[model samples]
Target chain A: MARNRVGVIGGGQLARMMIPPAVELGIDLRVLEEAEGMSADLAATGVGDYRDLDTVLAFAETVDVVTFDHEHVPPAILRELVGRGIPVHPGPDALLYAQDKLQMRAKLSELGLPVPDWAAVESADELGVFLADHGGRAVVKTARGGYDGKGVRVVTEASGADDWFLALAEDGHGGALLVEELVDFRRELAQLVARRPSGEVAAWPVVETVQRDGVCAEVIAPAPGAAGRVAQASADIARRVAEGLGVTGVLAVELFETTDDRVLINELAMRPHNSGHWSIEGAVTGQFEQHLRAVLDLPLGSTAPREDWSVMVNILGGPAEGTLQDRYPAALAAHPEAKFHGYGKAPRPGRKVGHVTVGGDDLDDVVYRARAAAAFFEG
Target chain B: MARNRVGVIGGGQLARMMIPPAVELGIDLRVLEEAEGMSADLAATGVGDYRDLDTVLAFAETVDVVTFDHEHVPPAILRELVGRGIPVHPGPDALLYAQDKLQMRAKLSELGLPVPDWAAVESADELGVFLADHGGRAVVKTARGGYDGKGVRVVTEASGADDWFLALAEDGHGGALLVEELVDFRRELAQLVARRPSGEVAAWPVVETVQRDGVCAEVIAPAPGAAGRVAQASADIARRVAEGLGVTGVLAVELFETTDDRVLINELAMRPHNSGHWSIEGAVTGQFEQHLRAVLDLPLGSTAPREDWSVMVNILGGPAEGTLQDRYPAALAAHPEAKFHGYGKAPRPGRKVGHVTVGGDDLDDVVYRARAAAAFFEG
Candidate 1:
C-alpha cells in the first residue's frame, strides 16, 4: 500500500509529538519547520517560513494531506493551497475562526453557543460604550496573533486601551480588537474533541486547567467533582464546536466554569492543546494520535480514560539552572510511575519545555507525583 | 544539566523504538546502522559495518554511553571501547555470555539456575553420546552468531551431523557445538527484566509467545492461566539471570513451560526482544524505554501491566502483496483501539515488518482484535 504523506506546516512541540503516532500508523510525515533545528526536526523536515506562500507550497508538494502545528498560517496561503487541490485539514474556512478572535466570537455566538458577552471594537470609544453597558471592566484582545497570555489585557476603563487603539488606527487597521466583559468564575476547564472529514467525532474527558498568570500550569483529567452533568456538558459543547466549524482535526475549547454552574466558551485552539497532553499517558488514545487519525480521515480511536484519575503538570523552564537531562536521575528514581516528556528544546524562563503525567486510581497521589516530577525539571 | 549522548550499535526496529523514549528523556541518540536507510534511519545515524574496529570506535567516540540493538557486536571490540573509558552497559564481560551459546549455558548452570541438560560437541562421536543419553534425539546449536532459528538443527543420529562435525574438524574448531536434550514442554514463555548499574531491577509479567515456523508470531502478556507460583518462578528466573550475568540492560529469558508446571531456561537475549514489544502499549514501561534507562544507568521506570490482558501479533510480510501502509486504512478503520507499529523496512516474505498491540479487561477480545489487525497487514 502507498503510505499517506502528511505535511505539517509548523515544527513546534505539537508537531514533535505527532511523529510517534504517524510512525506507528505507517504514515510519512513531512514538516516545514520555522528553522533548521526546531522541535520537529527529527522528522523529514524542510526549513521554511509558513507565511511565505511559495515556501509552504513547495513543502506541500511532497505530502498527500496537509495539517498544522500552529494556526499561524495566513488564510490566503491556506486558501491558495486548497485552490491548488492540496488537502489542508481544518481547511481555511475552519482555521480562520482560530486565527481571528473577532471571527470566532461572531461564529460561536451565531451557533447559539454560550460565549461571554462581547463585541468587536474599533476604537476606545466603542470599548467604553461596551464596558459601561456591562460593569465598566472588560477583557480586551487583539483580533489576531495572540497566545500564552500575549496580546491580551484586562482594562477597567476605555482609556486603558488608548495605546492599542492608537496603534490600530495608525496602521489603518479597522475593527482590529475583540472585547468581552470580565468573567468571574470559579475555575477554568478545557474540552478536547477530534473530528474527521467523514463526520466522525470523538471527545476525551473534560479537564480542569489551572492557569497561573494566564499560562496553563496543571491539568486534572475528567475535572475532579465534575461527573455526570458537568462532564457531559463539556463534552457536548466541544463536540458541537467541532461539528459547527467543520474542524477536521483536534479542537480544544477553553471554557470558563462559572461559580453558578455554567460553562461558557473562552477560547478556541484548532490543534492539540496543552490541556490534553495528559491523554498521551492517561487515555486509551492520545490527542496527538487522534489528531492524525482525524486529519487522515481514518476512524477515530477510543477516548476512554485509562485510569480513575490523571494529572499533567507542565515543566516551565526556570532561570538557566541546568539541562533537563541533569534532573533526570533524581526525578526518574523518585517517581517511577510518572511519565515525563521533554520537547527537546533549550530551556528559558517560563517557557514550556516539557511535562509530566501520572495516572492511577488515587487522584491525590497522581496529582502529587505529576507536580513533583515537573518541579524537578523546573530547577 | 547536560544531555546524555547514547551510541546504539545497530539500527533495526529495536533501535527505532528507542528514539521516542530518548527524545522524551531529553537525551541524544546516535546510531551506527549496518546499511543506509535501515530501520532507525530517522535518527542521527552513521552508516558503517559495526564489525570493523575502526568504524565502531569512530562511532563510539561521539557518545557518552554505548549500547546495542543486536547482540552481534564482537566482544573484543566492546572490550576495546570499554578499555578507552567509554561506558558500555552490558559490558563485554556480560555481553560475552549472550554472544556464545556455550558460554551462556556454562554460566547459567554454574549459577545453579535451572537449565536443560546439555554438553559441548566437537565431533560426530560426541554428538552420538549426547543423543544416546537423551532418547537418541537432541537439539544442536552453533556456539555463536545464531538468531531466529538460524545455526540450529535437530539430530537423531551421528550421520545426521556428519557434515557439521567434518567442517568443525577441518577448521580446527574446538567444541564448537552446543547440544541439549529435546525439551518436553507444553509451551514457550518469555520473562523480561531491566537492570541498571545502580542495581535496581524491574520485571514484567511473564508472557506466552506463539511460534510459527520457528518465528515468534504472537505474544500474550500475563500468559493465560499463569499466575501465583508459575508467574513468580518465571520473574525470579529472569531476575536472577540478569543479576548473575551482571547484564545492565533489558534482558529477555526465553523459557519452556513444562507440562508438569516447571519453567526451564531456553535462551537469552541482552537487548530489547520481540517478546516484550507488547509492553509498548501494555505495560507501564516499555522494554525499549527500559533498555535505554538501564544502559544509561538511570533509574528505570515501573514494569507493571497497564491492563488485565495485552496481546501483540506480529505482521509478517506475505508473498509480494502491497506495502503495510496500503492495509492501514482498512485495518485502522476496523480496529480503532489496536496500536499498530511499522519498522519502515522493505517487506519480504515472512519478514516481521510491523506489529499490532491491544489491551483490555477481556483477554479473548483483545487477542482477537490484535490478530485481526495483524492479518490485515499480512494480506
Candidate 2:
C-alpha cells in the first residue's frame, strides 16, 4: 500500500499539534521547519527556507500533499508545487486573500460579505481622506507580513502612517496599505471552517475570542448568547468565503460583533488558527485532524462539541526564569481537569508558548479552570 | 526545568498509542523497539535487545524514568536500572507478579483478594490430583511468557497437559504450571488504575470487556448493570492490587463476573491495557497521558468520563488486502462521529491492527457506530 504522507511548511505550534492526530490516523507527517529545534521538532524532517523554491521543491517531492503551518510561504513556492502536480491545500489562489489584507478586504466586499468599511490606500494623503471620513480615527495595516499585532497601527492623523509609507517606499517593490474605519465592536468572534479539495465543507460553532493588545488571549467555544442569528450568520458567511475562494483545508475567519449586534468579517487565516485550539479537547474531531483529512481528501470527521462549553487560554511568555516543565506539577495538581499543551519554545514576552483548555457543563467553571491552569506558566 | 523524558522499553501498539499523549503533554518520549518497522517506528530511538543489559543500560541513561510497552522485560534489567538510580515505574518488585501468573495468584491470595481456586503443579501427576479435586475440569497455563491464549489450555482430563509437561521437562530448568478450576462466569470486566510514585492513585469507572478467541474484541465504559455494588467492588480491588504490588504506572485488572453475582480477579497487567483504550476519547484525560504522568511522579489528571457512554471495537487483522488507510475513506464517511486509531501494522489474521471508539449519550448507538466503523476494515 502507498504511504499517506502530508508535508507541512514552517514549524510552529500548529505544526506541532498536527503530530498527535497524524499519528492517530496513521499518516506520515513531515515538516520543513525554518530552523532546527523549532516547535514541531519531532516531525521536522528538514530545516530550510520555506520561501526558497529549490528547498521547498525538494521537501514537496517527498510527501503526497503539501500544506502550511503558517501562511507566510510565498505564492511562487506554492504555485511551483501545484505546477509539479503536488497537491497543495488552500492553494495559492485562495491563500492570496490571506497573505495580503487588502486583497481579503476587497474580495469580501466583492462577495457582498459584511465587513468594516475599508479601502486600499497607497499614500498617507489617501489614508488622510479615509480617516477624515471616518470620524478622524482609522485602523491602518500593511498589505503583507503581519500577525499577532505586528504590521498594524491605529492612526488618528495622516502623519501617523508617514513612517510606514517611508518604509514601503524604501523597499524595491511598491506596496499598498489597508485602511479601515475604527469599528464599534462589542466583542470579537471567530468562525472555523474546513473544506476539502472535493468541495465538501464543514463549519465548527462560532467562538468568542478575546484579544489583549492585539494578541489572542482566550477563546470560548459556541460563543455565549450567539445561538440564533449570530451563529447562523457567521457559519453562512465563513462557508461561503471558503467556497467562493476555493479553499481547501482549514480556514479561520476572524469576526467583529458590533455593538448593534451585526457580525462583520475582520481577518482571515488559511491554516489552523488559535481560535480553534479548544477543539483538541472539546470537540469530537479536532482542527488538526480535520486539516489532515481535508488535505488528504478523505472524509471529514464530526465537529460536534463534546461538552456544553470549553474555554482555552494561551500561556503567553511562559515562566519568567524556569522552563514550562517546571510549572507542570503545580498547575496540573491544581487543575486536574484542565488539558495543558506546551509549544517547547523559550520564554519571551508575549510569545505563545502553550495553551490550556477546560471543558464542562458550567461555562464559568471551565473558563476559570482554563485561566488558572494557564496562569501557572506566566510567572 | 529539566527535560521530562519517559523511556519505553518496547515498541508495539501500546508504545505507539503513547506517542499522541506524550506529544500533547510536551513529554519527550523515547522508545527502545525490538525491531525496525514496528508499530512505534516514529518514536523508536534505539533498535536493540531489551533483554540485553548493556543495550537497556545505554537506553536507560538518556531518560528520566523508564516504563514498558509490554511486561516481557526481565526483572534483573529493571532492578539494575533502579540500582543505577534511574526510575522504573511498575519497578521490578511489581512487574514480577505480572510476568508470572503463579506469583500473581499467590500474592493476590495473600492479600485476601477474590480469585478463582488455583494451584501450582510441577508435573502431570500433580495436575491429575488437582483435576480430580476440582470437578474433573481445570484450566492449565504456563506461568511465564504467555499471552493472548498462547500458553493456556482447557482440560477435562489431566493428559491434556502431557505435551506441555514434556516441553517443560525438556528444558534445563523445570517450570511449574498453574492450574485453576474454570469459573462459571457470566461476563468479563476490567478496572484501570494509575498510580504515582508518591502514592497517589486514580481509577476509571469499571468497564465491561468482550473477548473473542481470547483476544479483546470490544469494551464498554461503566459496564452496564454495574453501577452500584459491582462497580465499587472492582474499583476497590484494582486500587488495592496496585497499592499492594507497589505499582507506579498504570495497572489493568481483568475481572470475572460470576453467575452468582461476584467479581473475581482474572488477570493483571502492569501497563496500559486494551480494556482502557476507550479512555482516549471517552475520559477527560486518556490513559496514555496519565501513564506518563504516573511514571514521572507528576500529579495525575482527572479520570472523569467526558460522555455518558463510550464503546470501543477492535479491528483485528485489518483488511484482507491493502492497508488500514485504504478503508479509512468509506469507514469515516459512514461514521463521522467515530474515532479511528491505526497501529501501523500489516494485515494478518487475528492480529490487532487498530480500533474505533464512539462516545455519546446513548449506549446502543455508540456501540453500533463503533462496530460499523470497525467493520469497514475487517474485509
Candidate 3:
C-alpha cells in the first residue's frame, strides 16, 4: 500500500511536531511555509502564501490530504480545494466557525451550549445598551482576525467603543462585532478532542492552563480534583462540540470554569493547541499522532493519561545575552525529572522557543519542577 | 560558557539518537560517517574511514570530545587521537575490552565475574580435547571483528574444526582461536550504566531483551519477575565494571541469566545500547542525554522509571513490498497506547529500521500491545 502524503499550510511548531508522527507512520509530509528557517524546516517544500489558491492547489496536488497549521487560510481557498475534490480536514465550513466568532457564538447558542451572555453590536449605542442591561463593563471584540490580545477591548462607557466601531466601519465590517458580559470566572481550562472523518471522537483530560502575558506558561492535566464530574463534563462537552460542528480533526475548546461550577465555551481551535502539549509525554497517545489519524479518517485512539498528574511549562525566549545551553546543566542537575524539548530557533524576548514536561503522582511537585526548569531556559 | 562539541565515530541509529539531546543542550555535534544517507545523515559534517588517523584528527579538531556510535574504530587511530590530547570517552585503554572478546573474558574472569570457561586453541587436536571435556560440543569464535552471530560458529564434531584450524594456521592466527563451553541459558539481559568524567555513575533498570535470528526483537525493562536483589546486583556489577575499567559515558553489560539463577557476563558495549531505548520516553532522563552529560563532565540525572513498566519492540524491515504508512492507521487503531518511533530509513528485510514503546502500569498489557504493534510494521 502507498503512504498518504499530507500537506500542511503553515510551518510553525505545530507543523514541526506533526513531522515526527508523520515520519513514524511513513507519511510523506510537505509543508507550504511562509518563511525559511521555520519549524518543519526540513520537510517543507512549497514556500508560498496560504491564501493563494494556485500555491495551495499546487501543494495539495502532491499530497493525499490537506490540513492546516493555523486558521489564517482564507475560506475561499479552502472551499476551492474542497470543490476540486481535495479532502480538507476541518473543511471550509467548519473553519468558518473558528475564523468568525459571531458565527460560532450563534451556532453554540442555538445548540443550547453554555456561552457568555453576548450580543452582536454595530455601533457604540448598541454596546452601551448591552453593557447597561447586564453590567457596566463589557468585553468587546472584532468578529474576525483577532488573536492573542489583539482586536479585543474592554468597554465601560459608550465613548470607549468609538474607536473600535470606527475602525470596523472603515474596514467595511460595520456589523462584525461581538460584545459579551465579562463573567467572574475562577480560572481558564481547555478540553481537547480529536474527531475522525468516520465520526469517531476521542477526548483528553481537561487541563488547567496558566497564562502569562496572554501566552500559556503552564498546563496541569486532569486539573487536580477535576476527575469526577468536571472531567466527564469537559470531555462530554468537547466531544459534543466536535461531533455537532462536524470537526474532522483535533478541536481545542477554550473554556471558562465559572464559580458556580459551569463550563462556558470561550473559543475554539481546530488544530493542536498549546494546552495539550503535556500529552506528548503524559498521555497514552499524543495529540499530534491523534490529529494525523483523525484527519486521515482513521480510527481514533485513547486519550488516557499515563500518570496521575502531568505538568507542562512553556519556555518563552528571554533576553538575548545568553544561549540556551548556558542553563542546561543547571536545570538538568536541579530538576532531574524535567523532560526538556527545545525548538532549534534563536532566542528572542517573549518568543516561544521550547517547553518542559514533568509527570508524577504529586501534582504540585511536578508542576513546580516543570515551571522551574522552564524558567531556567526562559530567564 | 561555550557549548561542548561532540564528535561521534559512526552514523547509525545510536548517533541519530544523540542528535535530539545535543540539539536540546545546544551541543555542536559532528559525526564521521562511512556512508551517505545514514541515520544521522544531516548532522554529520565529515564522512571518512575510522581507520584513517588524519581523517579522525580532522574530525576531532572540530569537536571538544570524541565518542563512538559503534565499537569499530581502530585502536591505532584511537591511540593517535589520544596522543594528540583529544579526550576520547571510553579511552583507548578502556575500549580494548569491548573491541576484543578474548580480552574482555580474561579481564572479567580476573575480576571474579562469572563467565563461560574458554581458551585459545590452534589445532583440531586442541579443540577435540576441549569439546570432549564439554560433552563433545564447543563454540568456536574469532578473537576480533565479530557481531550479530557473524564470525562465530558452533562445532559438534572434531572434523568440523579441522578446516577452521587450518585457515587459522595459514593466516598466522594459530593462537587466535577461541573454544568455549556452550552453556544452556534461559534468556539474555542487559544492565545499562553511565559514568561521568568525574567518576559519578548512574544505572538504569536491568532489562530482558528477546532476540530473533541473533538480532534483538524487544526489550522489557526491570526484566519481569527479576528479583530486586538480582537487578541491583546486575546494576552494581555493571557500575563496578565501568569504574574499574575507567570507562566513561554509557556502558551496556549484556548478561546470560542461567536456569541455575546465575548471571554470567556475555558482552559489553561502551555506548548507548538498543536495550536502553525505552529510557527516551520511560525514564526521567534519557540515556542519550545522560551519556552526553557524563562525557562532558556534567552531573548525571536520576534514572528513575517514569512508568511502572516499559516494553520496547523493534520494527525490523519485513519486505519492501509496502510503505510503512500502510500499517500506521491499523497499528495505531489497534493499539493507540503504543508510542511509535521510526528511523527514517528505507526498509529492507531484517534491517533495524525503528522501534515502538508501550509504557504503563499494566506490564502484560503494555508488552502485548507493543509486540503486536511492532509485528504490524515488521509484517
Candidate 4:
C-alpha cells in the first residue's frame, strides 16, 4: 500500500503541526526546507531554494500534493508545479487574491461583500480623491506584499502621500496601490474556514483578536457573546469567501468588527495561519489538521470548541536576562491550567517565540491565566 | 540557560507521546533506541543495547535525568548510572518492584495491600500443594521479565503441572516461580498518579480498561459506574505506593475490581502508561506534561477530566493489504468526534500502532465512536 505523500514548501510551525495529522492519516510527508533548525527540520529533506525550478521539481517529484507553510512562495513557481501535474492546494488563482490585495479588494467588491470604502490608487492625486471622499483621512497600503503592520501607512493629509507614490514608481511596481477609509473599529476578529476539493467546508467559531503594537497578543474564541446572530454572520461571510474563491485549504478571514457589529473583510490568508493557532488545543480538530485533510480531499473533522471559552496569549520575545524555564515553574504553579507551547526560538525583542493557551468555564479566568503565563515567559 | 535534558531508554509509543510535552516545556529529550523505525526515532540519538552499561552510560552523559520507556532496562545498569550520580527517576529501587513480579507481590503484601493469595514455588510438589489448597487449579508465572501474557501458564490438574515442571528443570531456570489462586474478578481498571521529588503527588481519576488477549484495547476515564469508594481507594493505594517507594514520575497501577467491589493491585508501571494516554486530550493537564513537571521537581498540574467522560481505543495493526489512509476518510467521516493519534511505524498485525480518544457528556457515545473509529483503521 502506497501512502499519499505531501510536499510542503517551507519549514515552520505551520509545517510542524501538519506532521502530526499527516502521520496519523498515514500520509508520507516530505518538506522542502531552507535551513536545518526549522520546526519541520527533523522530517523534511532540505531543499535550499524554493525559487529554483529544479529544486522545487525535485521535491514535488516524490509527493502526491504540494502545499505551503507561508505565503512567500513565488506564484510563478506554484503555477509551474501545477502545470507539471503536481496538485498544488490553494492553486495560483485562489492564492493570487490572497497574495495581492488589489486583486482581493476588487474580487470582494464584485462579490458584494462588505469591505471598507477602498480604491486602487497609483498616484498622490488618486490618493487625494479617495481621502476627500472618506473624511480626508485614508489608509494607504501596498497592493502586492505586506504582513502585520508593515508595508502600510496612514495618511491624514495629501502632502504625506508623495514619498510612497515616488517609491512605488521607482520600484516599477505594476500592481495598483490601494487606499481605504480609516474606519473607527472596535476590535479585530478572525473567522476561519476550511474547504476540501469535494467542496465540503467547515467553519470554526469566530474569534476576537487583541493586538499590541500591530502584533497579535491574545485571541478569544467564539468572540464572547457572539453566539446567535453575530457568529452566524461572521461564519456566513467566511464560508462565502472560501467557496467563492475556491479555496481548498484553511482560509483565515481577518475582519474588522465595527461599533455597529458589522464584520468587514480585512484580509485573507490561504493556509494554516497564526490567527487559528489556538485551534491546536482549543478546538476539536486543529486548523493544521483540518488544512491537511481539506487539501488532501479527505473528510473534514469537527471544528467545535471543546470548552465554553478559550484564550491564547502570544509570547513575544523579551529581554534576554534569564532562561524561559525559570519562569515555567512559577507560571505553571500559579495557573496550572495554561497549556504552554514554545517554538524553541532564540529570544529577540518583539519576536514571536511561543504561546500559551488556557481554557475553562470562566472566560475572564482563562484570559487572565493565558495572558499572565505569556507575560511570565516574555518578561 | 541550560535546559533539563531527559534520556529515555526505549523508543515505543510511550516515548513518542512524551515528545510533545517535552518540546512544549523546552526539555531537551534524547531516546536510546533499540532499533530503527521506532515511534520515537525522530527524537532518538543513540541506538544500542539498553542492557549494556557502557551504552547506557554514554546515553546518560548527555541528559540531566534518565527515565525508561519500558521496564526491561536492567537493574544493574540503572544502579550503575545512579552510582555515577545520574538521576534515574523511579530509581533502581522503585523500578525493581516493576521489573520482578515476585518482588512486587511481596512488597504489596508487606504493605498489607490486597493481592491474590500466592506463593513462590520451585518444585512440582509445591505447585501441587498450592493447587490442592485452592480449587484444583493454579496460575503459574515466571518471577522476572514478562509482559503481554507471556511467561504465564494455567494448570487445571496435577498432570498439567508435570510437563511444566519438566520444562523448567530442563531449562535449569529454578529462579523461583509463582502459583496463585485465580481470583474471580469482574473487570480490570487503572489508576495513574504523578509524584515530584519534593514528595508532592497528584492522582488522575481511576479508569476502567478493557483488554483483548491481554493487550489493552480501550480505557474509560473515571471507570464507568465505579463506586466512589473504589475510586478513592484505588487512588489512595497508588499514591501511598508512589510515596512509600519514592517513585518520582508518573506511576500507573493496574487493578482488578472483584465481585465485592474491592480493588486489588494487579501490576505497577513507574512511568507513563497506556491507560493514562487519554489524559493527553481529555484532562486539564496531560500525563506527559505532568510527568515532566514531576521529574523536574516542578509542581504537578491538575488531573481533572475536562469533560465528564473520555474513552480511548487502541489502534492495532491489521492485515497489510490497503493503505491506512484508505480508512482515514471513512473513519473521519463516520466519527468526527474521534481524536486519532498514529505512531509512525510500519503496520503489522497485533501491534499497537496508535489510538483514538473521544470526549463528551456521555461515556457510551464516546466509547462507541472511539471503538468504531479504531476498528475502521484496523479494517
Candidate 5:
C-alpha cells in the first residue's frame, strides 16, 4: 500500500517526458532538478547539485529507487548512493562505460563486441602511432565530460591534439584520451532496448538516425531497406550490451552501417536517448514509460511497432523569429497527423526545443509530414 | 512571439488528462483548481472558487481563452467573463443546454434532433395528466444540479412525486420538474466530436458505452455490430448538435438505440466525457488533445482508429485493499499491451479512479485484456 516513489537525478526533457507514464503507472516521480524552471519542474522537484553527496543523498532518501536523466553524475557520487544501500539503476559499474570512452572501448572489446579499432592515448606520440596504424587520421576524444561535439576532434597529425594531451597531463586525470579509426559509414542506426532487475529484456525495432554536426536531427523507425538479418544483429548486440553491463533501464546503442554492410557500435547511452523519441507516438509502449517500469522492476511492456512507418524530426532553436505557439496553427494545419512535443524550455540557437513525430502506412509521406511540421517550429 | 495562455476552471480528472496535450501544443495551460492537492495540482494551478465572480474574473484576466473541466460554473460568471471580452469556449449561450435538462430538450426539439417525448410540470397534478396520457409511467428529473443517478426518479403515480412537486412550488423556482415517457431502448451509444470557432469539425467513430447505476462502466470503440447507417446517424446527430450550439470544444452526445432501430438523444456534455477515454490509446489523436486544438481554433487531428478494436474499462473504486501501485505489477504482467490511466485520487467505493484501454485486431481479446487489467486495480 506504500507509494512506489522513483527519484530521478538531473531534471531535463527526458525527465519531463517520463511524467505522463509515471502518472499512468501510479508511480510518484520526484526529480532533483538543477535549478528553478527546469524542464521537469512540474513534478516534485528539488533544486540542488547532483554531484554533491549530501544533496544527492537527501534526494535518494525520499524514493524507493534512484535513476538518472543524464550520465554526467560522477561515478563516485553514484557509488556513494550505493554505499548508503539506495537502489541505483544502471549501477555505477555499468554507468562508468557510458561516462568514460576509454573504459567503454576497452570493456566492449574485452567482451568481443564489434567496435571500431580504438586505443587509449596519453601523449602525442601515442596518438601518432594509433593514427598511422589505421588510415593516418583518427577521431580523438576526451574520456569524460564530452557531449554534442565538445571535447572531440579529428586529428590527422599528432600535434593537432598536443594541447589536449598537455591539458590532461596537467589535470592529472589518468586515462584521459582515447582515439578511434575514422569510420566511413554508409548510414547511421540505433538500437533501443530496456532491461529489468529480473533480467527480462525487450528490444524495439532498430531505427535509422540522421545527425548534423554531431547532434541528432531525425530518426526513421524500422530503418528502410535494412535487411532482416541486420535488424536481428542489431537487437542481439543491444541485448548483449544491456545484459552484460547489468543495465536496469533503457539503453541506446548507436551503430554505423559501413559500406561493406557490417554493423559496428558507435556510442552508448544508459538512459532514455533522443534516438527513441519517435517511440512515444509510434510504439505500443513508449521508451519513457518502459524506462519507469524497468527501473521499478515491474513487468516491461510490449515494444511492438504501432504503425508500418514512423518519422521523428527534432525542433532545434532557429532565428528566434517567433515562439512555438506562433507556429502551432500553421504546423498543425499542414500535417494534421503529426504529433508535436515541446519541452517547456527557453529557446537558444541550435538547442533542442522539441520534436515532431508522424506515423502512417507510407514511409515517405510520414517522413515528409514530420519534417514539414518541425520546419514550422524552427522558423 | 507571445504565448497562448488557456485558463481552465473546475480542476478534476478531465483537466488532469488535458495537461499532456497542452504541454505538447506548447500552450501555457493554467487551471483554477477548486482546492490544493486536486487532480491537476501538478500543473500551473490557482486555488479559488469558480462560482465567485471576483475570483473567476481575476483568474480570467491572466489567460487568452477560458474553458471548463465541469459545467457547474454559473452562467452569470461565464457571462461576466464575456462581458470583459475574454473568449469563453461553449459560452453561456451554449452551456445553458448542458446545465438544464429541460432547456436542452426544448432546444434539441427545436433543432429537429430526436429526443424522447417530454414536458415540463410545475405540480403533481400536471405530472398525473402527463403520466395518464403515456403508459401510466414516466421518468422525472430536476432541471439542474443533477449528475450520475442523483435527482432522478421513476414514478408510476402522482403521489410518488408529491414531495418533490410540493418543494418545487414552495421554492419559487418555476417549472423545476420535467417528465418524459419511460424509454425502452436496446442499448446505449456515444458520439464524440470536436469543433473549432473556424467552423472546422472532426468526429470520431461512434462507440457503445455500458452503464451501471448511470455511471459509464465500459466503452467499445467502432462499436461491433453497429450498422454503417447507425454509425453515420450517430456522428451526424453529434455534429449537428455541436454546430447548432456553437460549441468551441469537444462535445459528447449520449444516445439510446431504440427497439425500433433508431438513435435517440439521451444526454449532452460540453467537455471531454468518459465514453471517449478509449481514444487516448485507440485513435490517432485523443479527445483531450482534440479538445485543446478546437478551443484554440487550431486544425484538429485525425480521428481514425489505430486498430480494428479498442476496449476501455473504468477502474471503479471497490474495497480499498491497496494502492494502485501495489496492483500494477500483477496487472502489467498479465496484460502488457493494456494502457492504464490513473487520476491520482483516493479510491472510494463506486468512484472512478482510473481506466485501462487495450487496442488490437481482435475485439474479444482486447475487451478481455482491458477488463482484466481494470479489475486488478479495483480490488
Candidate 6:
C-alpha cells in the first residue's frame, strides 16, 4: 500500500500539534527538526539546518508533500524544493509576502485589500515623511525575522529604528523597513482560513485576541457581537488575503477593527497561528488538522464552532523555577474542563510555552476558567 | 523542571492514540513495541519480547510509570517490575484477572457482582454436566488468551470444547475451561472508568456497543434510553469492579443488558478499550488522556460529552487493493463532519483498520454519516 506522507520543515509546537490529527487521518508525518529534543522530537526523523538545501532536500524526498511549521524557511530553499517537483504548500510565491513585511504590504495594497497606510522606507528621510503624513507616531517593523513582538517598534521619530538601520547595512543585504500608521482601533481581531491548492477554502469565525507585551495572551472565538458585520468583514478579508496571495494551508489574517468600524489587515501568517489554537477543542476541525488537509489537497472539514464560546489563554514564561508538569496538579485540579497544552520546552521569560482552552455556553465562565488554569503555570 | 515519562508495554492502535494526549499533556511517552512498524511506531523506543523480564524491566525502568496497550503481558514480568518498585497501573494482581477468564469469573462471582451462572470444567464430562444443567446450551471459553472471539466457543454438545481440553492435557498444564449459561441479552453496553493509584475514579457515560462476530463494530455514547436505571447500574458495576480488582488506569466493563432488565458483566479490560474510542472526538476528555492521568496519579479530566449524539462505526477489513488513503477522497468529501481515523495497518479480512465518528444534534443523522464514512473503506 502506498502510504501518504507529509513532511514538515520545522520542529516547533505547531509541528508537534499536527502529529495527533495526522495520526488520526493516517497521514505519515515526518519532521526535519532544527535541533535535537525540539517540540516535535517524536516525529523528528532528521535534525539539521533547514537552510542547508541538501539536508532539506533529503527529508523532502521521503514524503509525498512538504509543508511547514513556520514561515522562516528561506524562500530560496523553498523555491528549490518546488524546482525539484516536490509539492510545497503555501508555495514560495505566496510565502514571500509572509516572510517580508514590506513585500506583504505592497502585495496587499496592489490586490486592493484593506490594510493600514504603509510604505517601505529605506532611509530615515522616507520614514520621517511617512510619520509626518500620518501622525507623529507610527509602527516600524523590520522587513524580515520578527515574531512575538520582536523586530517591531513604535517609533515617534526617524531615529527610533537607527540601530536596526545600522544592522541592515552591516549585513550587506539592502532592505527597507515597513512603516505604517498606528490606527486607533477598538480591538484586535483575527480570521483564520485554510485553502487547498485546488482553490477550496474553509474559514472559521473571526475571533477577538488580546495582546500583552505584543504577544498573544487570550482569544475569544466569534469575536462576541460580530454576527452581522465584524464576523462577515473579517472572514471576507481573510478569504481575500488567502485567495489573493494564492496561499495553501492555514492563513491567519490579523486585523485591526478601527474605532470607526473599519477592518484593516495588521499581519499575515501563512501557517497555523496562535489565534487559532482555540480551535483544537472548540471547532469541529482544528487549524492543525485543517492545515494538513489543505496541504495534502484533501477535502476540508467543517469549521463550525462546537459551542457558543471557546476561550484560549496563553501560558507565557511557564514556570519561574520548574517545568509545566510542576503546576499540572494545581491547574488540572482547578479546571478539568479546560484543556491544557504544554510545549516540551524549558520555561523562559516571555516565552509561549503552552496554552489552555475552555469551551462552553458561557463566554465569561469559559474565559475565567481558561485564564485560571493557565495562571497556575505562571510561577 | 522534571519531565514525567510513562512507558507503554504494547504498540497497538491504543498506544498510537495515546501519543496525541501525551503530547498535549506534556508527558513523555515511550513504547516498547512488539514489532517493527507497529501502529505506535512513532513512539516505539524498544522492540523486544514482553515476556522476557530483562527486556520488560529495562524498558520499565526508564519511565515514571508503566502501563499497557493490551492486557497480554505475562504476570511474572509485571510482578518483577512491581517487585523492583516500578509504578505499574492495573498492576500484576489486577491484570491476572483479565488474562484468565476463569479467574475473572470466579472473582466477580465471589464479590457478588452481577454475572451469569458459570463454572470451570476441566473435562468433557464436567462440561456435559454443566451444559445439561443449562438446558444443553452454554458458552465455553478457554481459561486464558482470548480476544475478539478467538478463544471463545458456543457449544450445545459435550464434545464442543473437546479439542481445547485435549490441547490443555497435551501441554501438561492443569487448567479448567470457563463455561456459562447462554445469555439472552437485549444489547451490549460498556462502562469506561479511569482510576488512579490514589483511588480517585472518573467514569464516562455508559455507551451502547454493537458487536459483530465478537468484535466491537459500533458505539453510541450514553446508550440510548439508558438514563435512570441502566446508566446507574452500569456505572456502579464498573466502579465496583475497578475497586474490587484494584485496577488502575482505564477499565472497560462490557455488560450484557438482558431482556429481563438486568445488567451482567460480560468482560473486563484493564486498559483503554475499543468501546471508549469515540470519546477522542466526542467527550470533554478522551479515555486515552484519562488513562495517562490515572496512571501518572494526576487529577482526571471531565468525562462530559461534547455533543448531543456522537456515533462511532468501525472500519473492518480496509481496502483490499490499495491503501486507506485510496478511499479518503470519497469518504472525506461525502462526510466532512465525520472524523476519520485509520490505524496504520495492512488490510486483512475482518481486521479492524480504522473508525469514523460523527457528532451532532441528531442521532440518526450522526449514525448514518459515521457508518457511511466508515463503509467507504470496505474492499
Second chain alone, TM-score for each candidate: 0.97, 0.99, 0.95, 0.95, 0.97, 0.99
Q: Encode model 5's per-residue lDDT on A305-355: one tens digit a residue.
A: 999999999988842876777778778888888888888777788898899
| Candidate-wise lDDT, in order | 0.88, 0.93, 0.83, 0.83, 0.88, 0.92
Q: Candidate 1 residues A1-379, lDDT tens each?
A: 4537888989899999888777666677788999987888888469988999999999888898999999999999999999999999999999999999999999999899999999988777898999999889999999988999998999998888888888887888545689998899999999999999989999998999999888999999989988888888988999999988888899999999998899999999999999999998788899998998888888789898988999999988742676788788888999899898888888998898999999899888888888888888775
Off by over 4 Å in 2: A1-3
Ranking of all candidate structures by their lDDT, best first = 2, 6, 1, 5, 4, 3
| Model no. 3, DockQ | 0.43
TM-score of every candidate's chain A: 0.98, 0.98, 0.96, 0.95, 0.97, 0.98
Tell me the spans in candidate 1 whose CA falls farther than 4 Å from its real position. A1-3, B1-3, B169-175, B318-320
lDDT of 2 at B339: 93
How far in Å is the alpha carbon of B71 misplaced in model 4? 1.2
Clashing pairs in 2: none
Best by DockQ: 2
Worst 10 residues of 3 chain B by lDDT: B318-327
